[model samples]
Target: MDCLSLLEHVIVTLFLAVLISIYMNKGREEFFRILLLGLKSLPGMQGLISRVLKGEVTNFVKQVNLDETTKGGKRPPRVVIPKKGIPYDELREAMAKFKAAETNHVEGKIFAYTYTLFDEHFQLQKDCFKIFGEKAGYSENHDALVSLFHQAFLHENALNPMIYPSLRRFETEVVSMAAAMLNGNENATGFLTSGGTESVLMAVKTYRDRARKLFPHIKEPNIVAPITIHPVMEKAAHYFGLKVYHAPVGPDFRVDVQAMEKLITPNTILLASSAPQFCHGIVDPIDKVSELAVRRGLPLHIDACFGGFMLPWVEKLGYSVPDWDFRVPGVTSISADIHKYGYVVKGASVVMYRNEELRKHQIFTYAEWPGGLYGSPSMAGTRPGGNIAASWAAMRALGEEGYMSKAKELMEATIKLKDGIRKIPALEIIGEPCMTCFAAQSTDPEVDILAVSDVMETKGYKMEKQQKPSSLHFSILPHHVPFVEPLLQDLAKSCDEVKANKTLAKKGSAAMYGMVATIPDKAIINDFIVEFFSEVYKCN
Candidate 1:
């Protein structure tokens, strides 16, 4: 297409868009009309429009990450390869500095990312990590990236278990261990996924395929889950060709079982809930939902990705957690992350079914390939053997006794943290969170929760802002055991600051979070999110 012709088409499109926007949103209509006016007399209007969009979108995105992902709102220098090779020592020093600059999760300064007990404990996992591969190669200095033994199986792949039997054993043993934690029966079996999202994806694929065979007449399968179901389920539904009916939660933030049942149609293939949903960290009424699933003759998938490893130990600590595992009569499948409460490295989760028959649906196979037979357990090809090994090693390093001891400290800290939050008159926890994780909201309207998050960031505390009720998510791990009181001090101070200065809500980054929480027009918020991410990914 020629430039002038493209410009003419754009003009026509803008005119039509303005006319449509006039009815839906008067403000946007006027704004775009001004843009169109600027487009009229300008030479090379295409470049002008491109610059306008780049300025508008990238600026908002960069501003959003100013205090978070980026420093001082300036784009970081792009990394490029060098013509001359740098010494391994120089590279090690550079990487060590970079690693040093990372958030000291050991000091409990951050939340939502690293999950660990102590610095010394995690170094063991790092040592095991070297058994597979490290980008800079193994260092002779043991202390460089934590004491490393010998590196072996550097070229190992999990795709063919026959080739590397250790990878196969590691994965299967991890699955077995995860299944036992969730109270799986003798027949319960599953596969290792990259993480919670992929685990959820596999569950969706498995249940969808199962529905095809059991209920062939139903062409359009759907899933019935609570509104609080993790966004991974949203991704799963979008990726798989299925419809989802989201039932609202009750006042306590637990999914209303009756509402879920009401949404279930004859074509509903699976019923879904979380073992403490992510945002508020409240366990959905899985027992009640499981009963509903049994009555409806539908498969129930429990997303224990966040709470899977935490809940069993929480129960062992004598907390009265609701039955969410295989002990629940109708629970069919579960996905739990070994990375989260399991205290392993990133990208490891297990999705297990009630029995082997249900798990078979998750496997993929092809016989007629020219490259010979092809078979995959999950979505990924050439699965990393390191992840499987690291996960297994972490599990062995922390046996049942070790996990229970960690859980005791973790929950005790959570109790202290919850008590401290309750003491703060302006802030209140959203629900009775099952694990050390919970979301907090502003009880007083004068206090802007997002602004408090901004202040908390300044105080060197990482806070994940949530929108449903203008709250903040705290994923307290063992790292937080000693810092509970200190975090609460900062929290109280941040809330007071927000209350004192009413203008903080309109300040940097908080405005973006506030828009999502306070804005009634979800359509506009959706557009902002789409544009924000689209511009973020565009090359500078």
Candidate 2:
């Protein structure tokens, strides 16, 4: 090899390395994440490192195991298909056994997820499911009742109105109902999504595409949102190739409107705030943020996924709820989860827009295919009909009167719970919650919030723990109404017990959460989460 050739090779290599570093540094957090992941993938290195840190790794694994067992006893059977099919009766028995191992959310033993109503209402939902089990909206050959139920399912192919006219009608009506509830005018239109995440994703995608069309010269798009905005928005930005600039919140846990506005730039395509954000159950200053959005000529998205179904009724019942929905003039879109507060079976959410023109950006169409053209309304191509049908049935069965009554009960329970927490000297509510969900942080240094959570779990109350200022979250559902007093009593006892022995924080899930919160290197936390998900998906 010649000296000149070697010199040129070195120069090119160094130049490429510099360019790669610059590209990665553009998004430093994600860049470090990818770098760590690449290093972990090196052959034999990860295992060798794990062996070297055996003691630390083993303690983390033990904590994971303890947390899993504390949540629900032993793991369920990981069964593969049998060589020959089993009888239906045997399969049913096995299924029942597996289900028996889970925490009974119906009895209010669980708290974080799984919303339910009175037994009769639940039975009605079950009956509806049974009645429509064999039906699919893809076909038109069914009885009138089944056809009516089938209307709820909107297929991706339904973009061609001729294909599934009923689907279009059902979806339109659903969006209209949601829009009216949120105080949207006649121009409002949207489509039903599988869940809240997809709804938020669609909104992000819409705004990104809108920017691409209107500001073609802009190289990168960004969204300015409150730090408390649902993590789904972050996921959306990651998936759609956009950046998120999170604005700091105030001590009240609501978005600081001034801070959010200052983050907006020419490349900012969307501004977002949550209606009672999931962490602390405090609504951001939507009205104030809307003013900024209007002035900046940017689209604003209100994420009401957690509070949408309940807030209007709460306000109707005389609670002073903030302006968070379509009623706000500058609010361009809103995402609401029907499954959460609507008391419907899972996999149902609504995403609404102020006008059809904005919704056009959400729709996708592909032509020039050999098999003809294709179009999809949301992310998924073939969505489950049962989710939509069951949601419709649940909503219809629980009419406005039923929902209002339930909301009243939930609010009353929330009041009692908040009052109870306030009574505890060691704990304090994170903020003035606008809805039934709220978090309680430890006020006394001796009372570890995570330890309190562990004790609450032992008492058979499933409590969700949060970070960034450690706290325990509660979502008071109708099922929880009966158990509110008991929960408070247990919580009080737990606080006292934890305060008595600060070392309790060194054990079980408390220790794990403490480690996660205090860890400076988030890459390790990310790896832990990835590993935990891998464990969840393992069959054996």
Cα displacement (angstroms), candidate 2, residue 487, comes to: 0.7
lDDT tens per residue, model 1, 1-540: 999999989987987676677746777767667667756547898677767987896677556432223556653332211223334355345434533544444565653323454466655655565534567665543122221201122234678655545566667767877777788866778999889999999999999999898899999899999988998898998999998899999999999888998898989999999998999889999889988999989999999999998999889889989889999999999999988887766778999998988998999999989987889999998787656765665665556776788899988898899899999999898878878789999989889888999999999977898877788998888678878888999999999999999999899667877556677888988898899899999998
In order, the Cα lDDT scores of the candidates are 0.79, 0.77
For residue 488, model 1's alpha carbon misses the true position, in angstroms, by: 1.3
Candidate with best TM-score = 1
Segments in model 1 whose C-alpha atoms lie over 4 Å from true places: 1-154, 517-523
Q: lDDT winner among the candidates?
A: 1
lDDT of 2 by residue, 1-540 (tens): 899999979976875585578566677666666556665767898877667787685567566432222436463232221223333344335334534644454565743323456578765664564434555432322122233343323212333433333344445555766777888877887888989999999999999998898899877899999888899999999999999999999989988889887898878999999998999899988889999999999999999999989998899899999888888888999999988897766678999999988998998889968977787889987655545654544554455776788899999999999998899999999988889999999989899999999998988878898888889889988779888878889999999999998889899888998778788999999899999999999999
TM-score of each: 0.73, 0.72
Cα deviation of 508 in candidate 1 (Å)? 3.0
Measured by TM-score, how close is model 1 to the native structure?
0.73
